[model samples]
Target: MDRIKEKMNSLRVEADESAAKVEDLQKQVKTLEQENLQKEHEITSLTHKNSQLESEVETLEAKVKDLKTAADDGTGHLTQNEALQRRLQLLEEEAEEADKNLRETNDKLRQTDVKAGHFERKVQALEQDRDQWESKYEEMSKKYSTVQKELEDFQAEIGNI
Candidate 1:
């Protein structure tokens, strides 16, 4: 019947639309995954930098302590002691700068974590939607096949008559 053809055409259009949407969702998921991976790498690099800065600060502190001990032990000229004091001041400044950098890196790491979490959730939702659309497309195809078979059988009967 004409009505059956109309319904089949409509089903076909719906199926095609669902397929396109599924593909688009899949692409979005892929892009999000790539972004998430990039964020992870950035996090790792920042962590490494943070560790290095902490180590540097510790080393500088140890050097300052050693220089103080030397100055107090009276094992050098007065000029040598003055030079050591200046050097200590510069080392302390460097340590302070390193501490500041570490704090900034930690903040950046936290922000990256939040962004990664958001992208992961988005990817999961998109995947779920794609799965549902794929299931619908399969069901539509089966129904279309069944209807087409029925139509063929009816035509054969008509031809025989």
Candidate 2:
């Protein structure tokens, strides 16, 4: 009976050790499962962030294309502005030339007016001299007629005596 009790006690101790080892292994398995769940959640978050970044890249590319088109339009506008400035400069020069021509014409007209005024004054003086000469000629003709009549009367007187 004593030997049987000793064998039963030893078997009970071995059984207890085996149960403790199984419990430790179960705890390690549960910790590994928690770590795997955390890793899966991190992978899901990184995938969402990557998708958002790709979408942002596409949007930035579209914005760059629009900016290029706007730049092209601005270049055309600048060219048109340059052409307008050239035309305006030409018009300004033409206007200046016309003004110079007008000034010269005005100067010539002033000279012609002065010459016409001088000629009119000379014509007035000539008309006055012509009237005086005509009056002197009429006086000389009347005196000649009076002298002829006196000569004829003297001849008749001589014949009567």
Candidate 3:
């Protein structure tokens, strides 16, 4: 009976531990969601910048095309056109690199979401296990009480004899 009580105590401790672990995991998931929000904000900013750069590049390209269509053989116009073309290329590359970075950031956010989901599942399972352990502990306590009462009744009868 002493061993049974000891085991019950140990199970109660385990249930407490499960509760603590669930709290910890919930905190981690909250932190991860916060971080993901920040990253999304950053992605939005980068996307806006990329769009602005693309518009500028498009305008520059149109101007260059118009100048070339005019067939101006002047060296200065040619030089200016060449410079504009080079600027457009550089802008396009910058936009491409920014897009690539945005893709990578999105991938990272998805992975974080997956991890958060996993943590949540773990917390749920732990909570259920804790509940089961508590139920078992309660059942054991009732049994122990019944057994103690029976033992007391037996002692009383012996004393009467």
Candidate 4:
């Protein structure tokens, strides 16, 4: 009777430990799920931003083409000084546009760099979490096997009695 009570107490303790482990695993799963959702949101935002940048680049290309055509067409009709002044104005405008484009491109590049770094860190963190979970699972498996063997030995002893 005392041995049976001991076995019951042991099982109770194992059950409680298992329940706690299951709860902890559930929480880890929830955390990983939240991280996945955040990553999806980031990907969506980056995609939208990439599309906007592509549209802006197309618009800038059109503007450049239009300016070049206008400069070519206007050159033939002007006197030398007028032509020189017009050319200078067009050059100045082109330079300004180029500078503006360069600045915008640099800003976008910096933003992309920042996002990439953030993503890398998140990935590293996730990998660490996965490794920890795997290690815990291995430990749990070993513990379960040990408990099963002990239970079998107890059963055998009880049968002999």
Query: Candidate order by TM-score, highest to lowest?
Result: 2, 1, 4, 3
Clashes of each: 0, 0, 0, 0
> Which 10 consecutive positions of candidate 4 have the poorest summed lDDT?
72-81
**Which candidate ranks first by TM-score, i.e. highest?**
2
Q: Residue 38 of candidate 1: its Cα lDDT?
A: 92
Candidate 4's displacement at residue 128, Å, is 1.3
What does candidate 4's lDDT look like per residue over 31-71, in tens digits? Answer: 99999999999999999999999999999999999988888
Q: Cα lDDT of model 4 overall?
A: 0.93
Candidate 1 per-residue C-alpha lDDT over 1-161 given as tens digits, one digit per residue, 9 for 90 to 100: 78889988888898899899999999999999999999999999999999999999999999999999987776667778899899999999999999999999999999999999999999999999999999999999999999999999999999999
lDDT by residue for model 2 over 78-98, one digit each (tens)? 899999999999999999998
Candidate 3, lDDT over the whole model: 0.93
Q: lDDT per prediction? A: 0.93, 0.84, 0.93, 0.93
Model 2 / residue 146 / CA error / Å: 11
For 25-64, candidate 3 gives per-residue lDDT tens digits of: 8999899999999999999999999999999999989999
Q: Candidate 4 regions off by >4 Å?
A: 1-88, 159-161
Better of 1 and 2 by lDDT: 1
In model 1, which regions exceed 4 Å deviation? 1-76
